[model samples]
Target chain A: MLKNVHFGPSVLPFLLVLPQIIVTLVFFIWPASQALYQSVLLEDAFGLKTEFVWFRNFEELLSDPLYWDSFKITIVFSFLVAFLSMSFALALAIFSDRVIKGSGAYRTLLIWPYAVAPVTAGALWVFMFNPTLGIVSYALSALGYEWNHQLNGGEAMALVVMASAWKQVAYNFLFFLAGLQSISKSLIEAAAIDGAGPMRRTIDIILPLLSPTTFFLLVINIVYAFFETFGVIHVVTAGGPAGATNILVYKVFSDGFVGLDLGGSAAQSVILMIIVISLTVVQFKYVEKRVAY
Target chain B: MIENRPLLTIFSHIMLILGVVVIAFPIWIMFVAASHPEIRMTQVPLPMLPGGQFFENLDIALNRGMSGMDGNGVGYMMLNSLAMAMMIAVGKIAISLLSAFAIVYFRFPFRMFFFWMIFVTLMLPVEVRILPTYEVVANLGMLDSYWGLSIPLIASATATFMFRQVFLTIPDEMLEAARIDGAGPMRFFWDILIPMSRTNIAALFVILFIYGWNQYLWPLLITSEPEMFTVVMGIKQMLEAAEQAPQWNVIMMTALLAMLPPVCVVIFMQSLFVKGLTETEK
Candidate 1:
């Protein structure tokens, strides 16, 4: 990755890299290693007693139905988030790309949500859907439908998914718009001359050409829903209504910090690390393939 | 664009307007909520329009803060968030620039080792390892401090990689010319390289500033004291307190203030933000 003509090796380079190296070691590597080590040891809540029990935490986690439920919830949550956000973004991006005039204005109106934090988005949505005071809930009630996310697991899941997906649409839209822009206009023009309608051209040409962007956004959105939506869950549902919205990341937090199950939390952390590593590997591989193309 | 179909153009515009409205609806609701009085907010049909109480609520939320909480006003929390975001963005950009320069310029021992070490940080987000990291920070005596809030989160692999990519694109002749002119490494880095990559640095600063400002769980874990609470995290505290006293006006006002800066940055620095986002992800 270095340049062909590089400076000579010296002590300065070490000093230059030292700050990054120190932070990575102290914050990232050390704590990660501690998680691995703690996974193999079972300790009491007070840290007074400890027993080296290799793989027991993992065994218990694998066998625990609640952990499995959380796992399933995470899978459902991420998939729904990725699907909802990506589809909405793709549609918006397509329309934004199509319009010849005021496209920039539309984009400006759309992309600011990228800067809004997940928690803030959560607060906004939760406020709008508050059971007693929320206008949306009032509307739903007017339509003869009950709306109480605090008491309904399904509603809780839906609320969180909407909030998480809402924040992510801006990011997916940018990438999709970029992808749409990169396609040669001559191809579309030729198809139009060949009597292809707009819908037919989009299905046969645009979507296929934008598959790479779609795939990339899919992975990124899943990872985001997995890790970054913690604030949304924390603010909106807090994994409430019988743990319906409690994803794996929140579970690790509750199990470790609230339940005082250190070994179990460490095990969950190790599992999450594996998931992130695999997703990163897949992303890098696809990126390399894209570069090769 | 291939053919000017008037009806299709009209349809596209309609769909876009609808999409924009759907996206902006919650924000509109937040503003309306923020503008109304507390009693008006608690009513079944929350006010759909902005009320006269906007400045009055703003004054309360910004200065007096919410009651029954830690009493740190939104103004103070916004200052803390600004400091934390600035430190994180500047610190990440500074350290990453140095490390990237080193990796690209000097062939030192364990260069690949250090590179991979930084790369590993990407796979282990703070969420996964929250407990142990919290323990480490607590042990280091950095809790309830800005250094604690910013330093641990500042070791950014994406920024390092982005700078490295930018450095790779720089012409070798610049470095050769600088060397011929007897300019040392740091001098060349400061003068030539920094100037060339100014756009990239600015773009990355925008992305990292939002990232730092939006951080929730890390700040929530460490900053227990009210004075150290960030505005984004303070919104959560306000939400928790809303269950008891239900000060929806002040709480919504605080939420509005919390999201305003980053939103403004993204809107104003739209190009740089887009550049930073695309380049860093790549």
Candidate 2:
């Protein structure tokens, strides 16, 4: 992919790349390798003693019920977030496509939430669903629901899921809108002439064509739910009420940073790194296929 | 659209309205909460309409922040966030541009090696290696500084890749003509390439600014000093403090202020934000 005409090797290129290499080495590589190294070492809670232990940390982690619980919670949370955000966004994108008039207004109105921080989103939702003063909780009580996420684990998980999904809906909406708009109008027109209605055309013609975008967003949303929803859980639940809302990332933080379980946390970190690498590999493989398509 | 039916049109409007309402409801609640007094906010069936205490709540949050310990004003936190965001956005664009330029224009040893080095970083997000990265930053004595907040996060693979993609598509004739005129590499970059990639840079800046401003985990780890706290992360502290002192109005005001700048950028520079997002992710 090099240009046919290029400059000869010189100190300029090295100097240009020096900053990135140094930062990447120091911050990214060194630290990542440190996590790998720490995964195999057994260290006490205090900074006094340490010993090299092979896969015992990983073995202990595999046996730990809480870690397994966190794993299960993360899967459930990620799917809920991906499903809720994608379906809601897809519905909105479909409907917005139907109404040509004021579509820009609707898009502008809908897309600003992408700018909201996950923590800020959590704060807003928690405020709304506050057990004592939150308006949504107040409304729920009138409906005989008695919403108290503070003490209830299921409700806490739901609140974090809602906040996480809420911020992501904007991102998914933008992509879905772009995907829908890219479809040829002639295809839909053809379907209409063949007596298929709007719903039928959407189900039969549009959804099939939109599969690539859907697949891409599925990967993106899962990645978002897995890694990026850390702040949402931190603010809303703090992995509390018996760690019900504790996704893997939050578990990494709490177990490492809060619990000060160095080896266990490092093992979690290593596991997370593995998860990210696999996700990246899968995403790139599919993306190459998408590029060819 | 294929010949819209009247009933379908009505249904579309209804669905779209409902969607917008659900999306905007929490934000509207935050705004309405920010306007009313603290006492009004504690009651059930909260007011749907805005009250007239917006300025008063703003005054409290800006001038005398919720946690009233030193250096906790929302205004100061907002300034901290602005500086961090600007540094990250501008710093990432600058370095990514230089590295991309170097990789594309000059044939050098270890070029592909360095490229892969940058690529591998895409897998090592700050979250995954939180403790070790914290140790590195702590060892470097960068905690509580703007460098700690921005620099480690600024070296990005996606931006570099975006710029490489931008540079690869550039017509080679432009570089040939510049070289024939005896233009130096820096001159060619500053004079020609920068202007050519202006929109890409601006779009990247908008997205990175939002990304930087919205950072919670990294900033939370690095900045322990109240003066160093960013507005986005400061909201959590405020929320925690509110459990003791019921300053609901003040906290909501802080939340609104925290979300205002980036939301304004997205709403106003909608096209650029979208461009940066799609291209950078590529």
Candidate 3:
């Protein structure tokens, strides 16, 4: 989309674009190519020699039970995060939209959590649920149940999900509120003139109309859960309590950086790249075809 | 206004209040934890109310290191984070502005190719290619440096695409007016485009600052030296140490310190923050 009446091209345009191009190539393009290249090659433990083993890394990963289990964990984690955060945000947005007083204050109070780093969010959750000293755990014990994330995988998963979802609520709330605000007042008035209750109108009109925002947020949230929650997992569980919370992104880091499995980690990276590319495609399709982007 | 719905209004207030409480709960707890003495913080059913040890803990957390790690004070880490965030925010905006200007103004060979190259970067986040990227950073001899912390992350496509979007919306009349005055391309960009995109640039500055400050994994990967540890990454080390010593007050203080600047930025520049976030991300 260039301007029709524009200056002639020369060294100026190249100079303008050179910095971004250079950074992108050195950091983004080269590393991605390296990941792709290393995914197929098997190198010695000491880094002396390399062998090109076509698809063995992929085959081994597919066959490995832990990898498969983490795949399931990623799906379950992303699902819970998306569902919980979206529903919370939608509910809040609905109520926020219905309010006549103190709405801006409520919005401000709710949206500031978006500023909290995920790791800090995780740490906050960890403190609140710290089995011995945590208030929540103490409250749970008083309620005739025990809470200890360090030894229980289910509890660990719940802790992380809460932390991740908590951090996301602010973001989702902003979008959902914007989506709610953008709906025409006439539509709701028309629904009300027909004597439809608020719930009915929301369920019938608002929900359906908000689906595009919903779908867009669903993809955005899932992508967030898949990639951005590394810090959360790292800070909260380290994929521990017996590898219960090991999502794919964390696995890529631990495998490549910690476990020293070059081929395997690179393969995981390749797989992750594929996932991201597909998600980006989905997002672009929505923006191009459905959403008002 | 359509209908009074007094009952619904009350329910709405209740829901909004509950939403605010739930959203603020964890942060409140973190603040209270940061205030109490370490011994009190370790007590069961930790104090729901804040204690007077806040300034004391803040003093220790700022000057001395946390419970476990040594030599990387919260003060230094915060400074490092500020530097990194400022660099990343400025670098991304500067480069993106220049490129967006070029893309929208001039028709050149490989223009589409360059646009595609920037677009493709959106799909390749640092998480996917951590190892090779780390290797690249190491080879560049930038590891544990501020440049190392900020530069590779600057290679992202979001800022470029955002500036491109911003530039496209600037009316052609502005450029035409400037050109009829015999202004050069750079002259027009500096005089007209810069002022026109000032708000967008400021909003983006806020978002990118937060993004750069909240960065965890990249810095965790590249910076092995304790002195180079950022405040956010340093929290992990402190937490690990807490498992043994349980310095909840100090650790939580660091956590609060780590998050304060970004949170303050959001609260202060709210409309701009929301504009930047919704426009760029969605």
Candidate 4:
């Protein structure tokens, strides 16, 4: 009977993924291969003629100051957004973990921001930071400080960072809250009985136990900062005051799609893919083993 | 002791209240600005209270300058957003449940490989091969159509992973019992798996719906015609046309309206959303 079940059940599994595999192959893998091909080909200024010019686009990108600047901006933006959001989330999770009363309401309120699409969030933030109409700008003026994202590169960069961080902190909070709930209460009690204070226990015990959650969050946050900020950046500053806020992916969008420079866009995208994939591989090799679960 | 406890509680209350204000302020500002007139929007220390321009703004937004290639109306964009979101959500749910079941229940060749493929897609950002994907769709003549919008997104690695995880939670004994009762794999899946995974399906629906609805760039690139554009793309175009000076009240009103669908889904599916997160951690 077991042998009789073999061929039929085995075939069913292939059938399950067949549609998805085909669609992905046609839409995903095929497109990616085409993009790679395009990256090596030279295109005329008007985007009509193309010639195979292997590695020329990549070399140009490597030598371009603007490309490197955008790359650096991307890295700084991703790390800052991830770090700040994670820190805030950890703090909020710890605070809300202890007090059960009204916790549901708090979680719902906190997570509401996560539900808002990033574009809407960016638009809302842009409005709020408007010099004349935005409450933030009005308050800043009242407090005797100037703030205008349109003109100041630093201010524009800060606004983009803040907008990205705001949407993400809630997601980080969700994971941290989940992690906190899973931690054995007895561990905390044992530490307390051993005369360990909350801070000490949290540092030595809680942090180690929650490392898996933190690591997962780190990956998610980094990917989000790299891939997901297109909407936020587009709406908030459009890579503002001299392209200071222009991250890598946004650059790809501008060059490939807006400027119709397919080769340059593909080259930039290849670099982005390499950076992300290498980081991910490193995480899997080194960090995955340490994940407690 | 009572004095100290009250003070601590008061402090906590203050902090919580501050959190509420910080979270709600922007949303409040959107509403407040939407209700005020254009000239009033220029007033410094912008109005603390909502005014009477809300209806007027809505009238302009819903009715004005919609004469482009795409019928310029909020309703068309709403329909596009709803249809695309629903199509993706339903399609993803169907594919995920089936694929997950096949992987979990039956012994199969390359099971681990297929599983890894799904997980690996999660690791990839969409931008990695977006250009080529665009080429494929364009070549297939799917551009400027809803099929172009829905198909590529319908098969989500995240949803597949989620469903596989969910299916693993079900006991083997249940499947064995169904088999003993002469229920075939298809029948068992339809009756048992669907009902059991209802909550998960609902959760996936909300997430995928929100994702599809919020998609801007892909749709913007693929569909150049205005009538076929999603609300998000419409909003971007609106911002682009605003150029030097934007009408804040109209912009705020439109944004607030655009936000309603996702907000409604989140509020309506609160229980499932919380449960979905809690279960994923497990």
Chain A of candidate 3 compared with the true chain A, TM-score: 0.98
Clashing pairs in 1: none
How do the residues A41-146 of candidate 4 rate in per-residue lDDT, one tens digit apiece?
A: 9989976789999999999999999999998898899999999889888877776776647878877787777767778788888878876557898889889988
lDDT tens readout by residue for model 2, A153-237: 9999899999999999999999999989999999999999999999999999999989989999999999999999988988898
Instruction: Evaluate every candidate with DockQ and list the scores.
Output: 0.88, 0.84, 0.84, 0.43
The 10 consecutive residues of candidate 4 chain B with the worst lDDT sum are: B1-10
Kindly provide the TM-score of model 1 when superposed on the true structure, using C-alpha atoms. Answer: 0.99
lDDT of model 3 at position B232: 91
Error of 1 at B213 (Å): 0.4
- What is the CAPRI rating of model 3's predicted complex? high
How would you order the candidates by DockQ, starting with the best? 1, 3, 2, 4
Top-DockQ structure, candidate number: 1
Which ranges of candidate 4 are over 4 A from the true structure? A1-12, A46-49, A194-205, A282-293, B1-9, B63-71, B107-116, B277-282
Residue A174 CA displacement from its true place in model 4, Å: 1.4
The i-RMS of every model, in angstroms, reads 0.8, 0.9, 0.9, 4.1
The collision pairs in model 4 are A31-B132, B70-B227
lDDT tens per residue, model 1, A1-293: 98887888779999999999999999999999999999999998789999999899999999999999999999999999999999999999999999989999999999999999899999999998999888999999999988999999999999999999999999999999999999999999999999999999999999999988888999999999999999999999999989999999999999888898999999999999999999999999999887655
Estimate the TM-score of every prediction: 0.99, 0.98, 0.98, 0.91
Best by TM-score: 1
Candidate 1 residue-wise lDDT, B157-245, digit = tens: 99999999999999999999999999999999999999999999999999999999999999999988888989988889889888978
Q: What clash pairs does model 2 have?
A: none
Best by lDDT: 1
- Candidate 3: give the clashing pairs: none
